[model samples]
Target chain A: MLSCREVTLLLSESLEHPLKLRERMALKIHLAMCDGCHSFEKQMFSLRGVAKQYVNGLADELIKCEDELPPPPL
Target chain B: MKINLEKSTKTTSEFLHDGEVVEDLRRQMLKFATQQLGDFHLAEDAVQDALIGALKNVTSFGGRAALKTWVFAILKNKIADVLRSKQKTVNVSSLQGAGEEDENEDFMSLFDQKGGWNHDDRPSQWCDPEASLSQKDFWIVFEACLDHLPPKQARIFMMREFIELETDEICEAADITINLLFVTLYRARMRLRECMDMNWYQRSQNHAELS
Candidate 1:
């Protein structure tokens, strides 16, 4: 049984790299039983989602400005 | 890849008509450079120089990498040059004990002596986190949290997550080892997570209580 601390560490790493099968199984077993770890994992995913949204919004704003600009001179 | 290869035969002159795209690219470069350099004036000069250099070599830009990434690569070099000239060493070692703020303590406190979630500080279920994405103020707070990170951590985090730079590119640009890069990225994400858990989640509770 992986401890919550260990599980959380793996959770973050899973964002960057694919977990080994052993580590993935251990995380799954732990998360299946632990509500706290489950909630923590969900929070991590949510944070990534929100961060992507914010950055994509910036990209969209820049594109919008480009659209509004006057046509380039020949 | 096939489509890009097909389009690569067109000369740069055919695509150079849009001044607006250049202006927008300049703005993006300045913002990204400022994040990394933490100095508006220096960032401005770096972006200006990068823009001129990019324009001079515009014909050499194959349609391989995205335009933003190519411009950013140049800006990265320009910023590095300025930082090198300033003689400001990037002290990764001192980061461990750099401040009295006790960043290590803050992270440690989240875990119990038994290496499990601390009872009091363990995460709670956040309601409709997706709903907050559409709210403009959420990003304002998010960017504020990003800015609050140590400059080096923030710069690397932005390059990796926001700007979508490859790890190899970031490592080469910053001259950091892979271990240091991973550690810096982990610390940055932890800080940002803690910030959102407190500011966004806790604030919602406070607002509900007020109503």
Candidate 2:
């Protein structure tokens, strides 16, 4: 019975922490019936997926640089 | 002194000899530091200091976290230190601009009075979102989109997802309450999704049609 707005609000929180059993059930049921919330959920997933890959690649490039890391301090 | 020497020797022989990899680690740490500190010079200093700290306590690193994560943890502290030192004179208005009120407005704007998605603002399916990851220009556009986020939101989002910090740790590092952290992350994701839709996915679909 959760509204689409409420379901989307919980989306990021669900990624961060587990939703309570009732909240989880409500969200599942809402998403099943709500195309807007479903598309919203899929986009959120894809955004995180693409961002992680791109940022990790940047991190890897940083790690693969040719300049030497500074030596440890005395 | 003897133990210190022994630790240094072991750390060097085990991980330091790979000069290129170590350098890359430094660069990666530097990039993370820069994103946190928002200053090239300060980021360099923070990363250098973090490297020194990491090396000094190399033996203490039990490998519970990845090497990159360990170094970034040190860098986070270093960046926090720098921010603290600058806290007295640093401008606060820009950082505090949107506040909770704006976040409520953002939430409200997403839905109709009856709580459904506003028809005009509902999410659209991107064509082959996974395939966009392979395109060369995708990252360029993505980084630009990230840079477009509000400073605080971008920092918190990157800390949570890219740096992979725990929720409590992110709240502590950003000195924000848990509620504020969640709101900022929610907005960041929403904005990033919108940006990618218009700038990357939508454009690519049009390009495919023309070809």
Candidate 3:
């Protein structure tokens, strides 16, 4: 069984590249049983969703950059 | 190139009325251009050319595409032209693995001895995160997190997500290896997710409230 930490790594990596069959199987099985990792997987999708919207509204966004200069580090 | 100024339409009149919008767009364009060109004067020249080009053809902006999108397309072309003339040079010393050891440790700190999540720092469940997209305040906080991302990670993230470049292309553009790109992206995604949750969904008192 893969650790949740390892699973999270694979989960993020899956966005960038296709996982190996073994890695995919492990992640799928882990996600089925692990609620935390499941939530994480969904969050990844949400992140992409917001990112796409941000790009779609890029003009409005960049314009905001003008009203207030980039904010200080959080 | 000879577009008759006489062919102006209602869109042009409305667009011209919003002089403030054009001014805001110019400032934003300059910011983006300065980041890419690394020279204020050069970036100003490029943005000026693009804006002039855009206004000259403002009539062509008839309801087909967004006004900002139209102006940005011209700006992109002008920036590309300048880049071709000046050549690509990105000073990413921060990205060249200067503090990778610290970064690895920071990420690993989220997990435990057996690789389980830490009790205090486990990922929080974000409810109906998609719905946040429709809220105007959401963009404000989200942009805060984006600006807060570590500079190195921010660069790669922007290259991939904002600039919309592929992994291999990013590696070549940043003059980094594939391994480095993957690690950087992983860190960027993880941190960004956590930051958004903390600042928006979690809404801790100390963090900026999404008003």
Give the candidate number with the greatest lDDT. Answer: 3
Q: Write the per-residue lDDT of candidate 1 for residues A1-74, one digit (tens) a residue.
A: 78787887788778777889999999999888888888888877776766544443323321111011111110
List residue ranges in candidate 1 displaced over 4 A: A58-74, B1-29, B37-106, B128-134, B205-211
TM per model?
A: 0.61, 0.65, 0.73
Could you give candidate 2's per-residue lDDT for residues B94-207 as a string of tens digits? 345434434553667778988899987787765644442444455656677888887778877876776567778666555677888777888888888777777766674443
- CA lDDT of every candidate: 0.63, 0.65, 0.66
Off by over 4 Å in 2: A58-74, B1-29, B39-42, B49-107, B129-134, B204-211
Native-vs-model 1 lDDT? 0.63
Clashing residue pairs in candidate 3 (N, C-alpha, C atoms within 3 angstroms)? none
Query: lDDT of model 3 at residue A69?
Result: 19
Where in model 3 is the C-alpha error above 4 Å?
A: A58-74, B1-18, B33-65, B73-95, B98-104, B128-134, B204-211
Worst 10 residues of 2 chain B by lDDT: B5-14
Candidate 3 structure quality by residue, lDDT tens digits, A1-74: 99988988888888788999999999989889878888788888777766655544433322221121121111
Better of 1 and 2 by lDDT: 2
DockQ metric, candidate 1: 0.21
Top candidate, metric TM-score = 3
Higher-ranked by DockQ: 1 or 3: 3
